[model samples]
Target: MKHARIGHQSIPRWAYLLFIVLAVFVLYRIFQHRAEVAKASQPPVRPVLVAKVITKDVPLYLDEIGTCSAYETVQVQAQVSGQIIARHFQDGADVKQGDLLFTIDPRQYQAALDQAQGQLGQVKAQLGLDRITLKRQQELRARNVTSPQDLDVAQGTVNSDEAKVKSAEAAVAAAQVNLDFCNIRSPINGRAGLRLVDVGNIVSGGNAGGGGAVLLTIQGLDPIYTDFTVAETDLALVRRYLGGPNVKVQTDLSDGSIPPRLGDLYFIDNAVQPGAGTVKARAITPNPDRALWPSEFVRVRFILDVLKDAQLVPSQAVQISQSGPFVFVVKPDNTVDLRPVKPGQHQEGDMTVIENGLKPGETIVITGQLALSPGAKVDPKPYDAGNPKSDRQVAAKGAM
Candidate 1:
């Protein structure tokens, strides 16, 4: 029985070729996806702003939070008690020494002075008459017309009257002083604050109470004092460099319109503060415009010395981490090396002094540090702080 001869179905060469092509295409796609992922994993070349580490003479300054204090603060008060008759000066006026500030009731003082003067005149007349009588008595005694006792009595009367004249003179002088005090004058050259006692108010004098009621508050403005502190640990360093010549202090006022003022360091506390571990320091600065006020907070920069040929870089290049301050240094091949640095004084122009871990003429990454890692390649661009457009562009990139 021939089973109708079993026959085998064969696949066409074109179909087999098609299958091979599909398998090869799927494998290629898998490998291509892998290759793309690997490429994506590698970091791209970053564009960064760079600056050269410069060697120049940099003024070393210590910055501290400080306060502007008046050189002298005076509470203007009356020396003699009286009713305030008039206010001579306006509130918050700039006053000079001996400037009349207020006037008390001078009528009573004037009357007292007049009475004292009259008393003094009366005493003088009595003394004059006594002298005449004493001379006549002495002549009589010499000529035996009067007894010795009588002459002695006349001389004693003359002496007693002379004593009375002296007493009256002192009283008159004291009265004049009281009258002068009725016109209160500024004791210091300063700017006056609000009027404490208005016209028609009866104020006590210095003799009335421990201190007279404060009529006005005045604070010296020019050559003002700025009080700041330095950490106790830095005392030695501060003292060492402070001894150098041309050391100046700069004060940053709260008002931005005014430039930083130059001052001289005049005082240092004898002892460090107990708990804070800081030492009080003071500077005297001329405030001709009265820009600084008493108790106004300010920033004080004490320039101890100028470091010559120091390595410096833009301040933004320095970054802080858990270890310490570090900076990304760009190499010649555009690769960045994360370098730990010892940052020193920061200049007013955004330049910082690097004490270590950097050298002069070395390029440092300043702006694009956010996109950097160790050994990563970067496209270094020169950072020009003067260019406003470049700043905007950098800011834009940072936001992205």
Candidate 2:
């Protein structure tokens, strides 16, 4: 280096050589330290728990609490008041229209009818006398012994008697009507309720129990109605399903854990209640066994429509993140990836309908997604649900 230097600068050859060796060694050490640090900082690729692609049809049951109602209900009341002379129907008995339910005292109505009949008899006897008198007058006039004015008076007497007889007949008819009203008959065919009065108790004209206490409640149990409500958010979607030219609703109502009865939708309220934030809907159910009762609460199901071949996922896989509802998609390389999704109706138990952003064949992280990061290496554990044989397989394969 000194030999190559110009006159202004001079350097020894050994000094230059030593400086280059030290620079080369420092560069090598730096590279070695950098490699060690990079290896140490890189996370130990942890084996993560994962699930395999599960392919099956998920049953979707739209669940909501609903109530039951009777198709036709009537309150049995006594029309005529007297005294509770007899009870014709038992409590909770099924009755037909025109069946006698209660019997009030017929004595008062019978007395009135008897008085009317007596008046009618008296009027008939007087009319007979008038007829005889008129005939006698005519006979006398024909013999030139009776005056014309006297005969005319006899005719007027016969006419007055006839009008009196007609008036008495009308009175008898009205009294008969009142007597018939003493027997309280059922207006419709239905299930009857409890009896309000005993045989000896007196009943006022208005009600049987003397107060507003219902004498009996009769409800039609054959074809019962079940009422329910649905959220306003589903209105448009359900309307589209039910508003078609010839569309109808399919319903299910259950009591307790027993399987619900299948019913048909028949009525929907015209107006939506803004305060309740729901629409009232009704369905008809066959109550052949009297399983449905009046005022009994029942669960109602409304089938808006069916989603054909819609992608579905478990509710657990879906997580609410900063963006929106998303799922941890498990890639084939045993790494976790995030995917957004749109959720549909919530079905029974662990199933939910995926409206959008899901594929049928794609594997979603069903478990252990909370601690996953993008591109993190994982040791996937194939979890086989349902079948006992699959559980054995996981254990036998040593991937537990």
Candidate 3:
């Protein structure tokens, strides 16, 4: 018997290809799932930069914006009216006290002086003649040759001549004073400003009301004054150490091209400004090089006291959370702990003064706190204060 023909059934090429693709996908998924499980089982060890908490003396200070002012400002004006014959100093020259600055025409004043002197001489001659006449009249009266009324007249004439002589002498003194006024001199040692009047320019004399054509302006630059203000809330603290030995001020230009100038606190306004709610204060700083100029803006650091043995840390080490400020402290086992801290003023060199909750010799994380949690292991690295890039990197991470 013929058996039923056995039919050969073959799978399609596309179907086999599909099966192989599915098997490969399943194997890949299995490997990926195992990798994820392994990753979840082990915690990541983060790398961080850290610094040691230090102890040092820090200044208790108030920072403020201030302006430089001349210790003395003078608007020089003519004291006697005349044509300016010559200028003794150039514009913007440095002058000492009694240095001649200008010369006015002195011809008229000299002529007036000569006339006054001539009048004085005439009066003196007349007084001498009258005195001789009085003596002769007294002799005649003694001989009974002249009347008493004549002698009295002679004495009155001599007295009148003496009065005239005194009047002439006063006029002569007045003329001499006017002559001296023709030469204008600097009253103080200072730097002169631009000349307002040129030679041959006639300037009017200063009046009793102190108004006149201002010839020049002079400003005293050495030992300049820096004017600043303190907030009303801080006034009490400033007043407590206003005149104390530890109280001092340091002024620096905003550009910081020049070094800071140390000074003494000079003045404090008695009352606060009504609108500003700040009390004005002044500091006298030595500016021997004349580096400080009038109306220049500067930064003022009013140092009240010094804190001895204060704990300090890198400013970037301090982190702010919802609770408050905290720092990540590294332990001996390379683990970190979150510590709450009371931070004080930020001092020079990017340092923060820790008023509470930190001790000297402790290590705190300065950077890489973004990836850390409490009790997390870390790959520690030393903080480099001198490296500016480290600060910028920390700032960027902290910002994130």
Candidate 4:
């Protein structure tokens, strides 16, 4: 009590008063600093707000890798052994079915055919003589003028000559077929590759390596096939979305970097592939200009089904916390609320479907999630300010 009334134990009054003021000022500074440090240490966690946008028909697509190939291909080879007499059609030229591709030397086949025909004539003449003798002998034997043994000999000779004639006829037929094969023709209408053999070169049967010569190759390129695969797990989706005839596909050229050509799907594999766990599919595209070449790697896309009037939100708008999928809904009072949502399929650009949560006209943080609190003041801007395209799509649906 004495020290409190007389500062500094009976010291000067001005000195005691100054010391008291200095102590009071020091205490005020400490209290102010503590208040500031507490505020900084417990800073608020911000929330990224996005709009619970209404989802409408969004163009969805299933993209995959694929390859292009000709509809049909044929390798032309010689069927009969002969010298390659002449070559027809230029390299890489489009040819029609039955077009003469090469002309093998027909002289050997013709000579064989002529020889068989000559043999047939000789056998026929001998049979004629035998038949005449047999008829005479049978007539005489009936009258007892010829021996039975003579009639039997004549009959046997006629039968032997007839057999020889039949054999000669078969040989002639085979020779004629071989002659026809000397004129090599295209089996199908397509583009031709190159002539592997020059004129006057010897070619054996089947061109069995064609004496180191391959005639040509032809490929059908008008309507081409583009093949791709989808995951086996998505079989249900393929059945659902691919049923529509309007379902479109496109193929990219040059490592999928180029723009894709519009095509339509026509084939699907019946079973899943074992090694890759994928199901194969094929699409046909008209290549009047030969834009899709044979064996070219391609990037493909299937236009997914169009969702009719679905509720869509930004992909970033949906956040996963301890609870589940949620969006920070900004109320009119600028306070944020955590909105639990059930999401559906995603669509083109940056929109997704809202299955069970969120309603129209609900504003949520699209960005700045790291700075949001439950009751913190929110400066809600348009959801697509930074992303103009998304903003346009959002604005098209009337989301600000």
Candidate 5:
């Protein structure tokens, strides 16, 4: 009505103040969000530890289970049958070749030898008399004092006597050999097993066809053998490098408490096993200390060949993703690039061989990979593998 109702009514001062406060609060939130977005859009810089790839020759090896065996096993037995008069070696003693192990009663053999010698002596005397008779008969025949038949008979007797003497000499030699066999000696340098027959036991010595009742067993321990098997599928590769000088082998106790023993491949079976489809192989290891025992199970590794100038990296540096094995490489510009790699053999003590996608002297991120992305800026630091504290921390973080 009056003056068009004064179009506007007067607002409270507190209301104006409240409107201003609300507007200011909204504007401040908008600015903070924009700032955060801008910061996020920029590349993220993460601190990480890096290591350099090394170049060296690394051996390729195949690992399998094996058994330790004596290189040579001999069954000790007496060669002649007689009473075991004495035993010269104790059970389980180390013996050398030709060492006397047992002594059999040689009196009978000696008597036989004496009788043979006497027989040989008698034959020789008879042969001498026959030779004189033949010569006298020949001279008498030449003088026409004796008939040709007499000379012929004398010659025949001399020939017969010579044959008898030869037979008697052979008998003496046989008797001598039997006497020598009475003294049982070690056939090889090795450790003897338990005595099968004690002293005073009459042992059958002659070839009983069953090795004469095994008196003892001797096993050559030094230069021991580790017999193992490999899959037939890998036979081609194994055969290729079989005789190569670079090929090597190692073995360790199955328990893994002792250090590995170094050796070389010595034998390969002519054919693969029919049922198992595995090829038998053996390695000879120098065991001067007798560290390896017969029939002991062990872990065997066959080193096929060495890759010269191959790239090596820390084992932890290799990461597995959907695209396969990859690693985060630290570029010279302090940026990390995700790279795919072809990983080869993984060696002991945390070392890995990279077949491709890496080069020697290149840097790789070893730790702090959780926060990394392709082309992300990084604050790289040299990784000190000798530092135990950091290793422990990394291990803890990985567990988490």
Candidate 6:
């Protein structure tokens, strides 16, 4: 029968369209939620600059501040009192041993020497005449014609004249020495400083003990000394290798005008300096070109030993944490492992020696370490020191 269907109404076309639209919107929402959850489950991949661990012979060394000093310093002084009549050398001239440096007036000394010679000649003539008289007296005594007292008197006169001759000879020697002193000579090979006494100035003689007026300063410059100090705490380590064959020193000037110089450790103070807690040390460096000067400050590196086949890496790859120094090592799967390392001395060319905790051929992060964590994924890029962009990135990241 027309039945209950007579009360049923047909569905509207607009209702069907609205239902389809809601179903499609629900499906989109579900898919979007699933995508967000998946993203949250995965770790973020960060980009970083990295380098490979290398191995080489690395030097174990200590760095200290030092100063260059002349190997030998001599203050040239007048050895004999006289007026400086002439200067034989220019200021700042390099001189050899026995080189003439100045000339003093010799006329007075020569006159004294002449006078002594004259007196010696007079004494010699008298001695000859007295000896002849003694011989005549001796002959008379033998013939019993002269008294013994006369013979004795003649002998005495001859002896007295001989004594006078000897006294004159002593005076001549003294005068000759004074004449030779007129020419001043350099005693050592060195570089002469400015002349303190001019050509016309009078200077007093200095004794062998370095007394009197300093005429000029001469310092030995070749093979100079680099003087430095070591802290008391490190004294033991330095002493252990004090004279070892491998132990050496390297010196660098702040100006960098000359190349770094290598030398041997020359001296070390026996006692530590009171109140300073340091001991003085010296290095003997060859300075054939005279590039190093006295009292010039320099950077000193005391090389204790060389570690053979030591693991090395870029210095920036090592980072310090609260526990100690650590490095980010990249794994084969592009993940990083935060590894603790025992770092050794930093070397030239931005390299550092790894005493422990790292192996050769391992990849390590040099930059972009701030965003890294243990087991974190990374896009490792090769570190290139020549790349400006990489350097800028490193600087911006504040990589250690």
By TM-score, the best candidate is 5
Kindly report which residue stretches of model 1 are placed more than 4 angstroms away from their true locations once superposed: 1-53, 141-145, 208-210, 242-247, 316-343, 356-383, 391-400
lDDT of each: 0.87, 0.72, 0.91, 0.77, 0.89, 0.89
lDDT of 1 by residue, 1-400 (tens): 2443333334557998999999999999999999999999988788778888998887877789999888999988888898999888988889999998999898988999999999999989999999999999989998999999999999999999999999999989988999999989999999999998889999888954579878999999998999999999788888787757868889877666688899998998999899999999999998999988888899888888878888888888899999999999888898999999999877758888899999888898878777678999887788888885885576457435
Ordered by TM-score, highest first, the candidates read 5, 3, 6, 1, 4, 2
Total clashing pairs in model 2: 2
Could you tell me every candidate's TM-score relative to the true structure? Answer: 0.72, 0.57, 0.75, 0.57, 0.81, 0.74
Positional deviation of residue 101's Cα in model 1 after best superposition, in angstroms: 1.9
Backbone clash pairs for candidate 5 read 80-205, 81-205
Candidate 4 has what TM-score? Answer: 0.57
Per-residue CA lDDT of model 4 for 203-316, tens digit only, reads 767634444245778998878899999998778877887778558777777664555677788888899998999998998877776767888887787775666777878777
State the local distance difference test value for candidate 5.
Answer: 0.89
Question: What tens-digit string does per-residue lDDT give for candidate 3 at 1-400?
Answer: 2333323334567998999999999999999999999999876677788889999999999999999999999998887888999999988888998999999899999999999999999999999999999999999999999999999999999999999999999999989988888998998888999999999999987744567678999999988999999999998888787777889899999889999999999998999999999999999999999999999999999999989999999898899999999999999999999999999999988899999998899999998888778998887888888887975675455444
Question: How far is each candidate from the true structure, as Cα RMSD in Å?
Answer: 10.0, 11.9, 11.3, 12.7, 7.4, 7.1
Which segments of candidate 5 are over 4 A away from where they belong? Answer: 1-47, 208-211, 239-245, 255-259, 270-275, 376-379, 394-400
Write one digit per residue (lDDT tens) for candidate 2, span 101-146. Answer: 8777899899999999999999999999999999999999999998
Better of 5 and 6 by TM-score: 5
Candidate 3 Cα lDDT to native = 0.91
State which candidate, 4 or 6, has the greater TM-score.
Answer: 6
* lDDT for model 1: 0.87
Backbone clashes in model 6, listed as residue pairs:
none
Per-residue lDDT of model 6, residues 40-90, tens digit only: 998778778888999998788899999999999988777667788998999
Identify the leading candidate in terms of lDDT.
Answer: 3
lDDT of 5 by residue, 20-125 (tens): 9999999999999999999989965777788899988888889899999999999987888889999999998889999999999999999999999999999999
